[model samples]
Target: MTRLVVVGAGLMGEAIFSGLLASGWAPADIVVSDARAERRAELSERYGVGSGEAVDAVADAQTVLLAVKPADVGGVLEEIGDRLAPDALLLSVCAGVALATLQAGVREGTPVVRAMPNTPARVGEAITAVSPGTHATDDHLAEVTEILGAVGRVITVAEKYQDSVTAVSGSGPAYVFLVAEAMIEGGVHVGLPRDVATELAVQTLFGSATLLRDTGDHPAILRENVTSPGGTTAAALRRLEDHGVRAAFLAAVEAARDRSLELG
Candidate 1:
């Protein structure tokens, strides 16, 4: 049976498909369709999955995963939405697209799910938030969860909260990268070689994130544990505070959230 049809072969689309294969999904059960013949051919050759046009790919497919660009979503939806099996699931990861839009594009009673997943999905550490549409049932949501789990953690939230989720986890990696860049530059300023500074910054970030996840301690608590009353860490922390780092992050997230709202 052609169980899943992926409707894009872009970066995030490729990531999800690759993750599914890595997690043991059979190639024969998956088919990918892309408007670009080159993309379709490349993925078919690389992953050994069936490739075809969007409408043909979704035919009899139990689930359709839409990973197209925000602007291209409507065209793809129009091409395949009505063709989807009534009981099939339509899971989308297009940022700024809404459940209402997805539902309107699809056949009546087709279950739709809108998800916001970050670029980290390329590395299998993504945190995705999924919102169910009006026709989606618990089983449909579970199916979406199971598919996304091939990449990383999944959370379910109300549709109303998706913009906030996009601001946080969806665009969160860029914020972390910006911090890493600054940290590396700081290290270089203090006389470390650029390569050495990059390694140090990357490892520190990886270790700190691991610590945070493993310990589940409040970030403030963890920072306090590192900062002795008036030590070097405290001095650095004070400098960062004085420089408005915290406020900048707050403003950045707000801006991202507002942009997402505008896009919707």
Candidate 2:
């Protein structure tokens, strides 16, 4: 029997499967299914995993993972809903799709879980938020935590908070990238070569994030630690505040949250 069947061969799907393999899942126990034959062939050649149509992939599989786009969720579920074995776990990483919607698509009492994982899963450093569906129990959630933990940190949140999680962590990476872009450009403006600026910005962000994580210090406390009275960091922060950067971020997260609600 197949242990896991991933219903999409996209980036996140590939990430989870690759992470699993890296953590010791055998190739024969996993199968990847994609709508495009070329994609299916590419992953099979690259990873040496089995490939098949979605329906065939899920057969006798203990877990079915849906990594498709939100728009494709309904269709994919429709194709495999009734086909899933009664005890099989259905897990999804599609954004903006609700548990009710997923549970409705599958057979009655089928265990479903909704998860929001960011792009960093590609590097095994993602922070994923998972919420259980109506039929999901503690055992099912523990299984999900183990599966997702292979890629990154897994946090269980109430389903009601998932939209907020979608806004904060799911969309958070893009915001960090934008900040990195601006920082690199700022370095260039200060007479650094583009490559030098790029390296500095990347390392600074990385080091700062590591510090924040390792020290367990509040971000504000960390910022204050670096900002001497009337120093460069202080000057920069003053300018940022003058430009309302903090307010902009609040607005941005709220906008993302509202959009997620609309999508759901």
Candidate 3:
């Protein structure tokens, strides 16, 4: 029997599989399932893992990762619930699906964990937030943390706070990409070549993030450190503030959080 069964072959699923392999999991120890035969074939060919029907892939597995779309999760659980080993952990990355909904579809007392991971998982730098269901134990959460830690950082949060976590980190990558896009365009507007602008914008974002992570300093302090009185940085920041960029971000995150709640 496989040690882990991934029930979807989408980008996040592929990222998790890649991360696990990078973390030294043998391909033979993992199995994958997808609705499309072509996707199954692709994953098997690319990762050298076994591929089959969801029920077949999950049978006797130690852990079952439900990486399917939220709309499809119910059907997946209904199909595999009985087949899952009694002690197997059910770790889900289906956005907007609640633990109660997942538990409703599975066998009684089956441990369930819900995770919200961003696109950065593709690059092995994601920050995933995990929450436990009614039956999930501390050990189950730790197991999930270890599994997701293969991709990046993992933090435990109460189920009630998951929607907020989803809005901030789950949809956070697009916000960063939007900022990078604007910065690149701003450089182009200042007469820099597109390629040069892209490199400068991308590297600046990367370096700034690295500095913030490594220094443990407040972001305001970092901003102040870079902004000399009446300097270019100050001028640019003033324009952003004048345009209510911060307020816009606040509203955007609230909107995202509201939508996540609606989806659940």
The TM-score of candidate 3 is 0.98
Off by over 4 Å in 3: none
Task: State the displacement of the C-alpha of residue 185, model 2, in Å, after optimal TM-score superposition.
Answer: 0.6
Top-lDDT structure, candidate number: 2
What tens digits encode model 3's per-residue C-alpha lDDT throughout 78-187? Answer: 89888888888899999999999988878888999999998899999999999999888999988898889999999988989999998899998999999999999999
Show the colliding residue pairs in model 3. none
lDDT of model number 3: 0.92
Q: Quote each prediction's TM-score.
A: 0.98, 0.98, 0.98
> Could you tell me how far off, in angstroms, the CA of residue 147 lies in candidate 2 after the best superposition?
1.2
Judged by whole-model lDDT over C-alpha atoms, candidate 2 comes out at 0.93
Model 2 bad stretches (over 4 Å) = none
